[model samples]
Target: MISHAKIPFVVFETEPENAQRARDWNFGIHWSVPLLQDLMPPELFAKLASTRVDPHRPVQPSETLRFLNGATGIEIGAAFIPHLYRVQRSKLRALLAEGIPIQYDKAISTISYTEDGSTVAAHFEDGTTVSGTILIGADGTRSKVRNLLLGEEKAALDRLEYAALWVQAKYTAEQVKYLRSGHPLFLACCHPLGYFGWLGTHSAPDQDVPEEWVMNCYISYKEPIAEQEKCKKWPNEGNLGEVKALAELCFAEPFKSAFGWLGDEQEVWYSPLTQWDPSLPEHQWDNHSGRVTLAGDAAHPMTYQRGQGANFAIKDSLELVNHIGSFLDSETKGRKEAVRVYEQETKERAGEEVRLSYQNTEMVHVWEKVLQSPIMKHGLNPTS
Candidate 1:
């Protein structure tokens, strides 16, 4: 959106390389929020539509959707409800080359400024600094920038007892043939023993040699006791056996086979879900100061249950864009007012989304409950 607006901005990316490969994609979303479609311009929408995995894919995101049973391997609930789409982050990264100045390897250590809101500077761990009129922390959940801005080494997070087992492995020919195996979109299941799992697939231009795409599998469950006992778990410790054993507890049969499906080169990351307060009290963007602000996960770190983490960030840019025209009006206090309005509106809307996600995290853990929940029942029909 910034690129399309012809805005001149500098982005600091800690990752040396783009985390997304050519075929890799993520962010399965439904337009639960109303303002998204109209805010997107035609050209941008066209580009997104062109990337659909299949030509026959739905033109509009639907409110109706279905879930696969990990136990019986059968799909359940209403089909084609939530008009949804599987979007790749790489597509957006491709836009950055359009004159966006991104400084890689420049991780921000701390951000400081004068009390009077002048001379805002971002200090890097390597002793580098970037001074600007304003700073936006788009760093993500464990945002270092947000941590410094909020005056805490550890940003406040609500740790949910719902732990997840996430693993990325390569796909096989047979695996790929299972069209219903959950690819291009999301395939999910909730086990009666108290766990939910989802499968998503991705392909990149880099698949020339192996002709394989990447498969991501996640199993989330309420494990209050096990989760609270440790700060971190086996995934970080690189204990494959323990992680597999844990999955066995929440999955059954072929779904258990999904565990064995762990590719030889596994990049497993196990962790519990965490949330950030949407009240925006912890870090407020002052119109008078307007030196520091945050966007995306840094601002509202909700669970992926609603797929709003990325969507909200995109919506935030729209909010910023709405205020940009006036803010750039140098003759008046437009910029300050713009900051105030954007932050105000963003916080209110994001707060609601954060709260909803918290509820969704609970409902999804229980299959029967999610089936009747609005998420599984409602489709994003514009008319509705």
Candidate 2:
């Protein structure tokens, strides 16, 4: 949007670009592909194919999603669009951040408005400040900008009573073939034992070279967080044993076989699902008369069950660009009105998504209710 508008803007990134972290989850870009293709250059959009987990079936009408333990599998796909494209989060970010005016290591501290309230300034923890006509909190789930706008209590993430443990590891040729028996890119299974199993290729460096492929597998179950407990805890670095034990108990056949390939030296990570609803009354905050607002997950964070988080975030961004574009082109419409309209639409659209995803999250964990979930019925499309 900045490049198209020819507007001056700077992005403050909380972490350095090269900072090492675990391989993030893959995004299933289905309904938003047209929006992304329109926003990005043809060459850039073409480059995304290299990041595909399964280059073989990049654009199919339907995906064969497998299930385990006698539970029925689903062939879910969008009617208007083909099957979703699965791309690594890292690769997608690199593609999107190609040439933006981004400043790394600039963590947000607070937001202050101009005395006349025509502009907003963001103060960073690095003892620096930047002022702009508008401040957009595009940060992730635990956004600092959200805190300053809505206060600490309102900005807190709404935790769900579910959790997952993930492990990313390389596999032998035979192991890769065994895991791929279900699907090439990703597989989702709901067990009759009240657990969810997910296995996917994290990075397939070379499709011909199976040894270079890294697979990510995780088992999710109902792990209700106590009211006082803040986070889920387990052996972080070298705890493949614990995760594998849980997987053995939860999965069957191919899913279990995939986790059995994990070596003891591998790393394990735990995540307690959480989300934020911008539509909620308590989440309302002073937008500094439209000079200050949020975009992306900072505005609405939803559970990943329906794979709508990134889709909605992208939708929020593109719609916001359209709103701002209209505001810039119109002489009569106030900027406040532009931002207000954008936010209202986002709250209504993304807010319902958050609620549906939360419900999907709950339903997927229970075997008896899994098939009746929205995802099983309508696939990974947006609810609202």
Candidate 3:
């Protein structure tokens, strides 16, 4: 889970009462309270391992707020967890509990779309079928569902010309001690080449021993590599030569050591970072077609620079559910009315988000332009 630790600094500088007032007026009354933190660093992980607190214990907003104030330099009015593994796991469990049939091996072959409207049917590779009132394409960048809906072999997901390599390995006891000696729960080291890297430890809820902890090394760079060639040229693609070469060029000394320690010849996973074109009309869907609808990445797949993909997905779901509820409440209204309303609102809101997300991508990759903006300086600088 990615947590923003910059909100408290903004709130503190502005005075907590003023911050609460601003939030109450613009974000509704429920957002008035100061954010707090509950997770207590490595100690919390220790307790979870010892059964001091339930592994399923709900994470409080305060813990995150505190972390933000003390850690990041940015001042933010809000802090959000972009991807909550626990929430996803809980939802999966709930689906299983409700007796919904789950298919693990079967991949979706195609999405059948009506010639005139929004109702979509999915055909699995296993020859099974499922229909939905609304088709939400939460599927990632290479969304087969999107291709089927548009009746095209390719949808307009633009490659940002960047790649990310993520690795996981066990840290020795001494190394672990060194890492946590003075640092808090989270730490990120910025690379000189515009690449950002993070190393952290997340406790496995199911594990019983501290030595069995998992350490993560996430690194990203703006270098384009063919998907097929990536696998063959790197550790998985060929040998450790290419991986080490790229790693050495993108990372500094300690990180290079860390990368080498993690794996010398093992297959390293590589993902090409891509973004959607905000100016392209293909990204926009008209509700004029009636029942056919789209949500999440299907609607707007932006760059991950802002870390807003999953958060926006959840926001889309919430808005969709609300619109659905209102449509159902109106006895005389047709489903098309609901779809139209939802599309209109979603398009306007999501379009802006997509545009901003793309702009953020540019800001990260081209910091010179981003830093020149007045608003960016204010919100991005905690001491401002």
Candidate 4:
């Protein structure tokens, strides 16, 4: 919207340019298609086709499979869904930021307001400052903007009992085909031992070259009380053996084979799952008289179980644009009310999404409750 309006604004990125590309792939689901379609040009929206996990095997909407005991337990249906694109996030961002002004590697040190209080300023660690009429904190979970608004103690994310590990690996043509025996794009399963496994195609060769293809597999589970301390070492230790042992023990067929592709030297990214409950008093803030506010994961971080995280972020941006547009209109004089309205709507809407995602996260690891989980029952549809 800012780009369309020719509004002058600059972005501060904590990472260097192209750094996000390393994160590889993510899903763009049905819920945000209409908004994105409107936001993006038809030609650009059409480029999502190039990012498909299996372009040669294109279908209207590919179903995500869930398994139990080596058998398919549930298939997340595609009915009523318009687009389910596997997005290369960096590619999408590069397309959207075609002419936008962005300064990479600018990390925020502090946030403050002008003496007159009509403007907000962000102080960067590099000894530079940028001020604007309004500041939107679109940063991720550990957002410095949020910490400045709510204070360190209150802004801390609530760590869940679960742990997740992701391993990115390359495969030969034969191995790639065998690994995708379950699904060409993504599939997940829960074992009776209380572990959940997800395998997905991160990148595929257009020319069908074996060595050019890449995939990622991850396992998440509730950590046992006795081993919680040891799990912290998994990330820095750069180990895949333990993860391999667990997958071999709990999963079957393609899932096990995917894990087997993990070389002992391959890097593993590990984290203890965490979330922020937006409804909590400590998590709420004054919004600094409408000059400052939060958006996306910076406001309400939740588990990826329900896949609403990015959708809500997009929703927040749309709502913010709507309210800010109203405020900017000459017919209205509610300058501060614009941010207040955005906050109210985001608080209620994203708060509910955070709750539902947390609930789904808890249920997904437990085999018996997995089918009854909200995601399994409703697919990726939003919960009001």
lDDT top scorer: 2
Enumerate residue pairs that collide in model 4.
none
RMSD of each: 4.3, 2.7, 12.6, 2.7
Candidate 2: C-alpha lDDT: 0.77
Query: Ten consecutive residues with minimal summed lDDT in candidate 4?
Result: 70-79
lDDT by residue (1-384, candidate 3, tens digit) is 013211110000112221222111000101211110121223332232122111334444322211111123232223233212222222222322232233444457766667655465767777877666555555655666566666553465766666666655556655655543333233344343456554444443433443455455556656655663555355454434554565566654445554655555444566566665423566554443454566777777876544455445555655666566666567987677777777777677666766676565555444344343222433211121
**lDDT by residue for model 2 over 10-66, one digit each (tens)?**
878898877766556677788887777766777788887766776645567756555
Better of 1 and 3 by lDDT: 1
Quote the lDDT for 277 in model 4.
74
* Selected candidate, larger lDDT, 1 vs 4: 4
Evaluated with TM-score, which candidate comes out highest? 2
TM-scores of the candidates are 0.80, 0.92, 0.64, 0.91
Question: If the candidates were sorted by their lDDT against the true structure, best first, what order would they fall in?
Answer: 2, 4, 1, 3
Give the TM-score comparing model 2 with the true structure, all chains together: 0.92
Q: Model 4 residue 281 lDDT?
A: 70
The Cα error of candidate 1 at residue 68, in Å, is: 3.0
User: Each model's C-alpha lDDT?
Assistant: 0.63, 0.77, 0.47, 0.75
Q: How far is candidate 1 from the true structure (C-alpha RMSD, Å)?
A: 4.3
What is the Cα-based TM-score of model 1? Answer: 0.80
Count of clashes, each model: 19, 0, 10, 0
- On TM-score, the stronger of 1 and 3 is 1
Residues 1-384 of candidate 1: C-alpha lDDT, one tens digit per residue: 434354457888887766644234477545533345544554565555444433244556453344767676677664463555565566545633444477877888877787765658889977999888778888888877767766553466777778776766665656544533444455667766667776655433343433365656677878784654563644443545555675566565445666665644566666678888657565553434666777888888998765667677777867766566456644776555667777777778888778777777788777668676445644322112
**Cα RMSD for predicted model 2:** 2.7
Kindly give the stretch of ten consecutive residues in candidate 1 with the minimal lDDT sum.
375-384
